[model samples]
Structures are given as structure tokens and as C-alpha cells.
Target chain A: MVENYNDVKTINTFEIKERSYFSILWGRFKKNKMAVISLYFIIFLIVVAIVGPLVSPYHYTMMDYTALYQTPNAKHWMGTDDGGRDLATLIVYGLRNALIVGFGAGLVEVFIGILIGAIAGYLGGQVDNILMRFVDIMFALPSFLLNLVLVVVLGRSLFTILLAIGLTSWAGMARLVRGQVLTVKQLEYIEAAKALGASNLTIILRYVIPNSVGPIAVALSFNIPGAMMMESGLSLIGLGVMPPMPSWGGLISQGSRWMLSYPHMILFPAGAFALTILAFTFFGDGLRDAFDPKTE
Target chain B: MAQNILQVENVKKYFKVGKKDLKAVDGVSFALEKHKSLGIVGESGSGKSTLARLILGLIPPTEGDVYLLGKSIFKASKNEVKQLRREIQMVFQNPYLSLFPHMTIGSNIEEPLRLHNIGTKKTRKSIVLNLMEQVGVPPQYYNSFPHELSGGQQQRVAIARALALEPQLIVFDEPVSSLDVSIQAQILNLLLELKRKTDLSYIFIAHDLAVVEYVSDLIAVMYLGVFVEFASTEELLNEPLHPYTQTLLKSVPVIGGEIRDITISGEIPSPINPPSGCPFHPRCPYKKEICEIEKPILKEVKPEHNVACHLY
Candidate 1:
């Protein structure tokens, strides 16, 4: 170990560079080749969602009566749905909406989870008891049933679906964060931070959150896909985003009607949906492995 | 007279374990003067670490108060408490655990300075580098995480961190216990050198008698949440009044000396249900009749020496 240290010292004689936590995490994340590919694919999907509409041959709502039900022909790639809408354009818009809902709900869960978890874990006693009990109640509620009730009550809309999924999904996140916080808070450095005169907020934000990032990152990676799946499930039940505004779930649901007769209808959207889900799942699994504190 | 930098006034911390209350640091009181060092030596369950936390105001004492430069830390308001933290700092026991895993060694040392808004970015960097140098850590390790460094190097970083605030008193809780014997000496020597070069006082807690004697001017022998003996290091080592202290001193392995076949028999009594009186009486070799029924308070037996035993 001593010899290794000296060797590194000699190699970097004059250039003293600071390696960030993210850089190190990225380095670890890159080790898993599939995860790297999935990350790139997810990024590519996001990019497509952003610009695919502007560059596509037809608008998502544009219907070509003459070229209706065509499959993968030149100029009309990915065919057309039953409504004669360009399936490629529809899928682009669907990907955009799916990404939004997935990322939006994931952000909500992370924000709320870190807040409640850090508070309950750091401030033990009555505050902990009350907050954790509330979390327990949240846990006890049937998440799917609650999501269903919320979607019905709020009336089907993009924002409502995101909110419902976010609200229902955060309980697990809160519990996970709280557990992480509990363990990290007990570490000696936290007390050392306290002794060094860091405020409660500083300790929570700077010390606590950074240390607990591993688990939280893993949880968030899974939550994005989980949110997407929940939104898709809602759309599958016919109460997702309204028509015109294409969502991946709504597109797949619309396609499933012509199951045997027009396999093309289900084939395109379903394949995209499954691929995206698989990408996120693989990415999340890779993240879980990367951030597994035991590895390092 | 020397200034009293820190004072713990009968500070008691009780933790509820199931039905009974675990008296972790029951009515432990001591005063550390500026530029002086007080070593607290004890076994694992003796609450030495708990007492260190109470002194640092990391945890509030269930009863009594800890004073920093004559101001009570527990009673201080939120802002005032923060201000007091600048005057007191602590180096935790485990070197590996004392540093943030994510941050670089340089950043770890600079954190206390950053938290207090002590200097500009440029100045903080220079201060961190200077501190790293002072603690004998290599400046090239500035960007290295805690895991990359050896245990001794990590401890140096931790010490550098504690020193950044320039606190008057730093409480070291078994800072060298986790290091190898050779590394322990190096760290201890660094601490001694630092102590010599500064006006900083210390509350050094350790289980090792030799290490405590090497670094401390005054030493307190703790047993089951209370001090059984307190005196100057020389006085305590030369003429230990309490039987427990005597056993502890005799047990320290000596070079080229007879190996005394002496050990404290039986387990330390549970803090939740401590012995009725003289917490060490059950394991003490020289226990009197009065030692079992009534508890003895720390009373001065000799000039500047205190013992909490009936025999004293």
C-alpha cells in the first residue's frame, strides 16, 4: 500500500486535480457496459422526445386517409395507427409525455422523500414518531387503489397522473431515505460536523444527503421506471391522458384493440414501451450495483 | 490563575433502555484550564465517549450543564450554541469513520472553516493545505477520498479538520485506539507536538493507560459512568488510590519488566442497573463494608487529588 501510494505520487508530480464525487460515481457506473448503453439509450430517447416531433414527416394528429394502416413503407415509417395518424409521430409524442411523467414523478418522490426522511431520521423523539407514523399510514394505503381514486377524482390529465403517481410512490422512497438517514446520521463524521458548528440544515444538506446518495440514487432510478409503469397501467385501464395528446400507455392501449388482425398497431408502440422499460430497468440495476457501498 | 476553558458541572446523561434508565455519564464533573490537557481513561462501557459528546454539546445532558469559557452550552440559544461550537471541537475514535467518504481529504479539513464562513475560497484552500502540512498529511492527497488514505493518514486529516477552527479545547475520544501500535505512537506524538506548539487544551479519552499518560497533564480514571480517581498523571501513576486505578496501571504491559498477573475480574456492571454503591465495588479487590451500601462522591484526599472510594 505504501509503495502504491508513492507510485501514484510520482505519476502526478505537479498536476493536483480534484476528483468530484460524481466523477467517481460515473467511473463506477461506466464499469457496467450494459448500464452505459442503457444510459445512452435513455438519453437518446429523451433527445428524440425533444426533437422527433419537429423533424417527423407528419404531425402526431395529422391523419393520412390514403396511406391509412400502412406498415414501415418509405416516407411512412413505423406505419400508421387505426386513426391513420403517423405511428412514428405518435410514438415520438408518446415518448415525450412518458419521459415527462416518469421524470416528474421521480423528482417529486426524491424531493419529498429526502425532506421527510432527513427530518425524521435526524430529529428523533416526538418529531420522528409523528412523521414515521404518518409514513406508516401512507405505507398501509393500497397504492394502486389510491392512484386510481386520485385519477378518477382529479379527472384524467397529464399533470394529474404525474401527481397521483408521485404521491403514491413517495412512501417507499421516504422509508428508504429514512432508513439511510438513520444509518448515516449515526456515523461519527456527522457528530464531528455537529461539533465543528455546522447548523442542522447544513448537516442535513451537506453532510447527510451526500453520504446517503448511494441508496437514494438507486431508489430514484427504480422510481422513474416505476412511475412510468404506473402511468402506463392507468392508461391501460382507459383513464390515462386524453386522446390527441399521445402517451405511450394510451398508444399501446389503443393498439391492443386490433390484437390479432393488425399486429402492427400493437407491435410498434408495445415494442417501444417494452424497450424503454427494459432500458430503465437495466439502468436501475446497473446503478444498484454501482452504488452498492459494499463493492468499494 | 489559568483560565478555565471548559467546565462540566455535575453533568448527567441518562438513556432509557426498556424499563430502566441507563446512566451513561452520571454526575461526571471536571474542569479543564486553558493550554492544559485532561486525559480520561476507562474501559469500553465506562461512558468515556458519552462524556466526550456531552462536553462537545453533540448531545444534551439529561441533567446539569457544560460550560465553555463560562457560558452554558445546553442552555445557550441556537445561534449561541453554534457560536460556542467554534470554541470546542472533537476528534472521534474511529479514523476511518470520522471522515466523510465522499469528500476529498482537503475538503474534509476545510469543511469547518467553510461552515463558519471563515475565509474566502482562495484563503480556505491555502488554510487547508497549511493544515494538511501541519498534521503531517501529504498535500498531494488533497483530492483523495478517505478510503484511499491509510488509517494513520485519515486520522491526520481528521486532526487537521479539528484544528482548522482553532478551537481552544479539542476533545479526542480514543483517537488512537483504532490505529496500529506503531501508528498509534506516531499519532500520539503528533498530538503532543501540536499541544506543545499551541495554547489549545484537550479532553483526551482513551482506554490505553500508557497513551493517556503520554499526552495528558491530568488524568481521570472512569468506571461505569463516573470517575473513580482524578489526579495529576504522575501522581495517579505513582500512587493510584482507587483499587480500579491500581489494577488499570498494573495491567499496562511494561518493557523489560515483570508481567504482573493482575486483571479486573468479572464484567463491568450494566449501566442500566449499576451496582448500588461504589460502582466498582463488585470487581474491586479492596472493598470495604461501607462501599456496598452508600455511594461515595469524589472528595479530595490529597492536595489537587480526588478519589471516590471510602478507603481514600
Candidate 2:
């Protein structure tokens, strides 16, 4: 509508600043107050996880034998556990461990999901049928049981647990990404890209994936919490990180034994885990709403 | 003989729908000369869009070949096909859906240049600016996304992107049908101006006979999956030989052309199980016993004029 020919000539000297995709995504993402709060909460959790242990006077392994199962006080916050380890320190370190597994396993799951989904969606027909069938087969197995089995076989460690969670959880993400890719690939712009002589890889990376990023981002947000929950569940069953490492799930399991006598032990770690998952879910939901073009 | 920029030799494209093969484009052949425009007018299910895809090499034909600058596009290797793409481009109908929604107008237009590894960044930018100007897109809109612009503006950007490669032949699949009448005229004028400035051949596909007549040098009337009539624009409009072409011309709401009741009965038959013999026989008012038994091939009835009707 700005149709002045003379003004057009002046535009050559006018440098246009490019607005990157992430900036636009951020602009949309910030609109949801709940999502924004959730994002801040996630950032806070990450910071505490990374820097909390470094600054804490009490280490997760260090135990005070004189004050066993002491309630919250200045000397010991969130009380001491059955082992007389500071529950506050254990909670912080436990949160950090949960987050590591959440993010690490979540990223791996997303990577696998995107690869399989992109392939299935872009190359429909026989390739789609085969890959999607594999996804169906994966869906048939009880994912939690499979993760437990994997942890048991591989000898439970952070690496094996992360791998187990990532391997089992990707099928759902792959299915979600595949559905998004199918729709995006059919858009007229994709055909236009093909006509422009864009290679399959170029079309997928540049157009299809970027267009479908909204749903994928939403899926990623949800996957982190899902992975964290999986890790917690495994740890609760005594198949998670060993006793030396303080995991949120392991702490909750230990606290459950003293549920009647010491409620604070179960309360602190369980609350943190629940709050973290809740924040992620809210953020993921908000992202889904924000990225949904139909919502606008 | 003037150089033929593109030649389609009996190109046939069939899709299997259930147990039957849907003949989307069957034995269609035509040659487009340099700088000449060929308008393909057809109804919704006439395979005009499919024909455009075949020419663009987005989909390969079941039989025959498309020759671009004397090279068979179907038989071309991956590298050869990539090279062939630089010579041919396309403008889709829905401008809203054609341009990449995520990219800025400048980036969308510069995409082909980047894809083909054409000019340096500075050169590509300048080229994009020039194309934007040529397509009547203002410079301020260069950094704007597709959704920010109106339907007409988005189409102009699509045109600019198509022209970025300086392709010899550009297939326009009802480029202006999705815009307002006022906007359609503006875009049509821009296309005409471009055609004059650059000797670019166009395969313009549209269901609107009037719009097709305005821009086409040669007009082909397609019904079902075949060309019912093919001739120069003026001759086809003035003296339409095929019954289908006459009906199409009559259907065009003229300002004050002797108001007479002209109607054709029946619907376009499904391509999957097309009517026996002539595909249009079911809809043809002048259908005879032979028309239902034998299919008529396109034959020259006049110099540079061809028709595929038993009556011919």
C-alpha cells in the first residue's frame, strides 16, 4: 500500500534490519503471562541447579551425626535426612540432577523424533508407512517398563537412565512431528520451493522444519517434564542414580519410608518435583497456544 | 524457425486411484516459442494445474517428455534437473500460500538466487531490490513478512521471486485468480509490462477466459485431461471451431454481446473412469454415435490452429 515511486528510490539507501525467527518467536512467547512466568521459573530452576551446590555450605554427601532428622532451623535448613544430610542441600542437588536428566534426555528424544518424523512426513507413501509402523510398534510397549528394563540391564547410571528415557520417549514426539511435517510439507510454499530447485534437504531444513517449529517447540517443552518424571519414577524404584548422588526421585523414595514420622522429608523433594513439572507443562501449553497460527 | 523455449511431446501423467488409473494429463503436447505466452483455459478438474507441474518438473510424466532448451527434463539426471530448474520458474495461484510465511519479502525473493549459488550477497540484495521495484513492490516492504502484505502485494513478491532466476519460461498457475478485480488488473498489467521488457515465455493457466485472452499469444482450451482446442488468441476468441471452445467463449459474460441463451449440459466426468471414447462426449451438445465409440486426436484444421473434435 505504500506506493510512492520516489520513496522506492530512497529505499536503496535505507538499510532494512532483518528480524530473525527467534526474535519473532520470543515476541509471541512473551505474550502469555503464565508461560513467561513458567519460563522464568524454569530459568530459576536451572540456575539453582547449576550454582546452588557451589555456594552451599553443606554438601549432599556430608552428614552431621549429632543432629539426625532435625527440623528446619538456621543451622540446618529443610531439616536433616535419616542420614543426617542437610535436606536443603540434598533438595538443591537433587533438583539439579533431575534437571540434567530432563534436559539431556529431552534433547536426545527431540533429536530422534525430529529425524524420524521429518523423514516419514517429507517422504510419504512407503517410507512413511514403514517408519510410522515402527512408531506404532514402539507405542505398543509400556514405555516405563521398557525404561526400567533398560536401566536394569545397562546397570543404572545417569548416562544409561538418560539414554533409556530418550530412547523410549521419542516415539510420541516423532508421531507429533510427523503429523506436523505432513501438513507443512503439503503447503503451497513447499511446492514453490521445489519449483525453485531447492534440494530435499534444503526444503526440509529451511522451510518445512522452520514452519513446523511451533509444534516441535511445544512438544520439546512437554518432553523435558516427561523425561524428568521418567527419571524420578525410575529412581523411586531404586533403579536411578546410586546413593552417592542425590536425585529428587531417590530422596522422595527415602522420604516415603519416614512418611508417618517425618512428613517434611517426603514433602520437600516431592513438592519441588511437582512444581517443576507443573511449570514446564504450563509453559509448554502456553507455547502451544502462542505458536498456534489459528489462535491469532 | 524461432527457437522453441519449451516443448512437451505427448506428455501423459496418470495416478492410480484405487484400482483405476486417473488420467490427469493424457497425451498433451505443445511447443512454446521464446517470449510468447500460452494460456491454458480449463475448468476445475481439467488438469491445467497438473500440466503446469509436469512442465516445472515437480512431477514426472508417466509417458513422453518435456524438453527445455532442447534438453529432456524427465530423463535429466539430478544435477541436470537442478540446472534445468534455473531455466524455468513458476508463480502459484494463492499468493497467501505461495510465499514463505516465515521469511521476509527480501529473503523470499533472494531464495532462488541463494539456492542456485548465483550472485554474492550484495549483488543478490541489489537484484532483489530491482525485482521488487519491477514487480511494483515498494522498497519498505523488503523486510516485511508475507502476511503483513495484502493479497496483491504478496503476489507481486511471488512474481519477483519467480523472476529472480531470470528464467526463460515461467509457468503461472492462475496467478491472479485469487486477487480482487482491481488488484487483478494491476498484477496483469505488471505481468504484461514484464513480458515486454524481458523476453520471458509464460504458460498462463486460468479458468477465466477473459483474463487468459488478455495475456496469451496462443490459447489452449482444456477439458478433462486433454486440449480440446488450441489456436492463436485472436482467432480462438473470434472464430472458435470446437464446440467446447464456443461454449466457453459464450459463458464469458460480455458487456453487450447479443444476449442469447447458451448452455452446455452435464458435469465434467471423473478422470478415474472417464466417459468412453471422447472424454467430453458426455457434455458435448453435438455428440454423435461415433463420438462415443472413437476418440479424436488433435489435428490441424487451419494454419497454426488445431482442434480435437469429431465434427472437425
Candidate 3:
């Protein structure tokens, strides 16, 4: 029997070395060239935002009253806006604000969404009915309109802005979480957990949450750009980062007052908004592809 | 009287279909004794799996009670029912889908121990290793994911997971039907060996009479949400009663050149508008005039054998 066990040992060994989950996922994600390109662009953009001030020699809010609206050049590359501040510094500051709102608000929404959805979905009947109804009510409301109203009521502070965005954004995240939770909660592993005398709390936290990280992570990635856009939109309408505290949106908002006379002002800010959204979109695609079973 | 461990009392599960209600498991009943096997054989819509699910309390019945070790499982408090959960674990059809992909083989086995708060993490780790050895997975596979193992290996891991709590009873829902024939034999033998060591009782639900006959102490034949025949495996095979049971036996295709009329006329009717008296009347070939009007209650034709047919 011992001598004949060679085949079993060999077969077992072969199975043990087939592939790791992370490796399989990573391999699949890397195959998508566009997602890779997006990942690079997003990372580069983040790094640029962090190191913007050290690389450039200008305080964004510093006024050069005499040199207001200067054209693009080496000294004041990409030109100045109506406020006579460095356009470069404004873009960087805007980049920082955009990322902050995008990620900060996103984290809040996803955390709340997962908690609510997981509980609601796992514990069906009355609990599911009640929670889903709340989610539906929120989902039925126009998020953009809600954000607009919230900003008006709360006034324009960074905390208030993130809070408003997070509050408005979580409805969609919650719906996605609830759907994933419903499907995963029914999986045999979860049933096994319950059969093992695992408590509802233990099952949700241990099995359901970890298993759901794929979709949740993907959803978070997709939501960031949307949050950034919302931030940019609010700032453009003067409900975001207040005047003299330069943002790409605030800068462009000011520059747009002069319209065709100073087209660079509108162009640069719009370009920043488009670039940020595009990069995030690609990064999101990479993450979505990464979690798929067939990717590897 | 027969050292009965669990008794399923007139269980009924119904779901709303549009405006009307559809009875899934309608007034089904059975009983099992400790350290014995009960085989539940049925077609896809025959509600065998649903009965298994109800017995396991994965889903509460629309109307019925499952007594585990003679304690009401469905009506029990959360804490009380948890005891039943630990006592009665389950092995599923697809082991690959049953085991958590994110978890390692060891962690998967340690779950029940952690849930029941039986032992500390350190001791539970040892128990997991012991379980792994019992099921033939080595210590090296402890850190491996579900996707790393073959179908047979994965099934073993799933079995180890069910065995983690050292439960008295295991509800195996077609545990071997998902694998290759050779692998099925190995798993079946493993299950028998496990029963020997622990004296574990099993409610083995399967589609194959051949496989069920190999592993069962008692067999119950179900058709369209009800049992038509139930007896000891040997007796049920040798002296089969009920038309449905006969048809099912005929359908059993072996490796040899054996051929029989496994094929019965007409489809199993929808449970919503079941053939007035007997649910099996449409597909049941032995149907007489009385078969269409009044349902035949299960009557014991022998000391422990029961059959529910007009002919019986």
C-alpha cells in the first residue's frame, strides 16, 4: 500500500501547485491593456497631485495683481487666471481636493452600504423588506439634486461637501451590496457555516464580507471618478472650495467670466476634469476584470 | 421505540406563485433512528432536497416541525436550534461550490469549532489537522484554497468541513453525484468509514438508487412532493412495492447490458394543480379509477415497510 501510494502523492502535489487566487486574478487583470494604461495614468496623476507644490514655485492663493491673466509661458506655464494666481498651483490643489472627496466619501459610502446590505440580504423577510424599502426610497431620489440641496443647506466646507457626497452616493452602493449579499448568502459555504452553528453575526463578518470584497472593491473604484466629477461640478457652481482657496473648478469658474477673451482658463480646468475621470474609469476597468474567474 | 433520533412531522413548504400558492413539500413525514442511515430518493421536483433543507433548518418550513434527537428544531429558540446545528451538519452536492474559495482547508474545518465555541483557536487548529488527516488531506493542504484541489480532493475537504463539529448526524445531499464514477466510489467508502468511526447517522439524499442502496439502511421513494414507498434498502429492492418505486428501479442503468422501461409516460405534473387525489396519478401507470379521486395514505405492508399506492 505504501509503495503504491506514489500516484496519489504525485496527483496531490500537482493539485497543490496549480495556481494561487491572487496570482490568477492579477494575471487576468494584466491582460487588459487599456486597464493597465488607465492604472498607470491614475497612479501618475495621484503622484503628481501629492508632489505638485514641491515641483512648482508658487503659492496658489498668492496674488500677482499686476500679472493677472498672463498668457502661457515658461515663467507662468499654462498662464494665469482672473485672480492672477499660478494656474499650475490651482490645478494641483484641485487635484488634491478631488482625490480627497472621491476616496474619503467613497470609503464612507461603501462601508455603510456593505454593512446595511449584508445584514438586510442575509436576514431575509421583514429585515430585508424594511432595509430594501429604505434603499429603494433613497435610490428613487435624484442623487445630483439631493447633493445640490445638501450643499445649499450645509454650506461649502470640505467636511460638509464630503458628507453630502457620501450621503447621496451610498444608495447605489447599498443596492449593489444587497444584491451581492443575497446571492452570496445563499451559497453552500454560507449554509455550511450556519450548519456548523456559526452565528448570523459571525457568518456575515467572516464569510459574507470577505467573499464580497471583490464586487465592493470594484464598485468603490467606479464610484471615485463620479465623486470627483461631483466635486468638480459643485466647485464650478461656487458650492465647492471657496474663492481665493484655489481649485481647478474655482479657477475655471473665474476664468469663464471673461469667456472667449481667456479661453485657456476654461480649457485647462475642463482638461483636468476630463483627465481625472478618464484615468479612474480605466483603473476601475482593471479592478473589475481582476475579480472575474476567467481572467487568469 | 426503535431508538429513534429524529422525527419529521407532516412538513409542508409552500411558495406564492403570482396570486396562487404552490405547495412544494406537502404533508411529508419520516423518522430516523440514531446511528442508522435513511436514504431519500426522488426526481428533481420531488422535494427531497427541500426536505433535506428543512431538516437542516437552512430554511424554515411553511408549516411543519423537525425533531432533532426528539427536540423541535423549527420551533426551538435561536440558542436551542444552534445545538441542533452542531449536532446535524451537511455535505452538499457540489463540494467545489460548497467550500469557501477565500478560506484555506484548515480554516474551513475550524469554522464549526469556532462557531460552537467548543475549543480555543490553538486546539481548534489541531482538530482541523486531525480532520484533514481523517479525510486524507495532508497538513500541506491546510493553507491551500479550494481552487487548488481536484474534484475528489475538494469533496474530501467539504466532508472534513462537515465532520469538523464531530456531529452525530450528517445530511448528505447527493454528495457523490457531482463527481466521476471512480471518485464517487472513493467518497462513498470514505462516508462509510466515517460512519464506522463515529457511529454517525446519515440522512443521505440521492437521485441514484444504486448508490443509495450501497450506503443506506432505509430507503424512501418520493415522487411529486410525496413518498410513495419506504422500506429497508434490502427489502425495498428485493420486494419492491408502489408503481413509482418499480419504475425508479427499472430506470437504474448499470454498466452491463441491462435495459428496462425506465421511461414512464407523461411528465410529473405541476405541484400547483396536482392530479386531484394522488399527485403521482398522471405519471403512475398502475392508476385505477379510485387513484384519481382519493389519495392513498401510506400503509405499512410489513413490520417496518410502508407503501402508498392504491394497489398496495
Q: Which is superior by lDDT, 1 or 2? A: 2
Better of 1 and 3 by DockQ: 1
List-wise, what DockQ does each model earn? 0.68, 0.60, 0.44
Model 1 lDDT on a 0 to 1 scale: 0.88
Q: C-alpha displacement of B270 in model 3, angstroms?
A: 2.7
Q: What would the per-residue lDDT of candidate 1 be over residues A112-175, giving only the tens digit for each residue? A: 8888988888898899899999999999999889999999999888998898889888888888
Give the per-prediction TM-score of chain B.
Answer: 0.98, 0.98, 0.96
Write the residue-wise lDDT of candidate 2 on A1-296 in tens digits.
46787687676555455666566667777888988999899999989988999989999889888989888899887999998999999999889888889989988999999999999998999999999999999999999999888888988788888999999999998999999898998899999999999999999999999888888888889889889988988888888898879998899999999999999999999999999999999999889877766655
**lDDT tens digits by residue: candidate 2, B128-238:** 999999999988888888987999999999999999999999999999988999999998998899999988989899999999999999999999899989999988988
Task: Give me the displacement of residue B16 in model 1, in angstroms.
Answer: 1.8
Query: lDDT of each prediction vs. the true structure?
Result: 0.88, 0.91, 0.84
Best candidate (score: lDDT)? 2
Question: Which residue segments of model 1 deviate by more than 4 Å?
Answer: A1-10, A13-15
The sequence of per-residue lDDT tens digits that candidate 1 reaches over residues B1-312 is: 237998889989999898889999999888888899999999999999999989988888999888899999988998898889888889988978978888888889999999888999999999999999999998889988898889999999999999999989989999998899999999999989999998989989999999999999999999999998999998998999999998888898889999787868988999998999889989988888999999999999998799999986
Per-residue lDDT, model 2, residue B203, is: 88
